[model samples]
Target: MKMEPIEINEITGYWTFLRNIDWRDPWLIGLIFFHIFTTTTALLTRNRINFQVILFLTLLSMAYFSEPINEYAALNWKIFSKQQYFDSNGLFISTVFSMPILLNCMLLIGAWLYNSTQMMAQLKSAQMKQRSRKEAGIATEAKKTQ
Candidate 1:
């Protein structure tokens, strides 16, 4: 007996692929929480290396070693009956998986830098206002004594 390959529609294939993702995975949940924590802390507190390193490692693990990637690749093959694209076609499966992780890493760093700059600007503005107030107070006292 011979079996024929089933052709997959783009929308249905993607929907099935998304459904196959294991949302219940504890590590993935933890990673989600970690991202939230890192983003909030970076925005609220002084920038630090430890948090950045942890975020990088978590993202790296998700991109490279997680079960979701392999599952997606297998599902792609099963649905399409062909090898997943790796630069052959305009669409690359692995790129789609990794781009978000890379973009988020850039965003984390950008957020930290932006927050730090804003804090510094506020500090400088406060210092200038305080200095101006002190000088004005001293001038008033001198005029009264004269």
Candidate 2:
């Protein structure tokens, strides 16, 4: 059997590539809905630990399923030619997979920093109250001894 090379034109720009994405793909749709659900839950939940756990799971799922997601994108885009696939795969992966992960990581980091700061403030307040109580006790003891 003989194989013939298939020709593929260069992808124009980010918008064009995005426009070509197959929104109907089950994997893509599922990921989108899952991400939305995670984000909503993270926002609504008061527990910082819960938010962190959800974000971690979301990131893990995104990383694990990236291959299948990219495969679908490639098939949808019809980039079957070896040279074309290689050339475009990086863009596909970055746009479809890495971008979401990066954005979510940023959100996770922001939430961590915000929660940490709030915790530190709380600890400081508690320590100050304890120190004041100790000082008051010491003053009372000195007065009794005098």
Give each model's clash number: 0, 0
Alpha carbon lDDT of residue 123, candidate 1? 100
TM-score, candidate number 2: 0.66
Q: Specify the highest-TM-score model's number.
A: 2
Give the per-residue lDDT of model 1 (tens digit) for 106-137.
77678767878898999999999999999999
TM-scores for every candidate against the unseen true structure: 0.44, 0.66
lDDT of 2 by residue, 1-146 (tens): 11223334434777765665655656667767866776665566546687577767778787777777667756664443222232345676776566767677677777778888999999999999999999999999999999
RMSD of 1: 7.9
Q: Model 1 clash pairs?
A: none
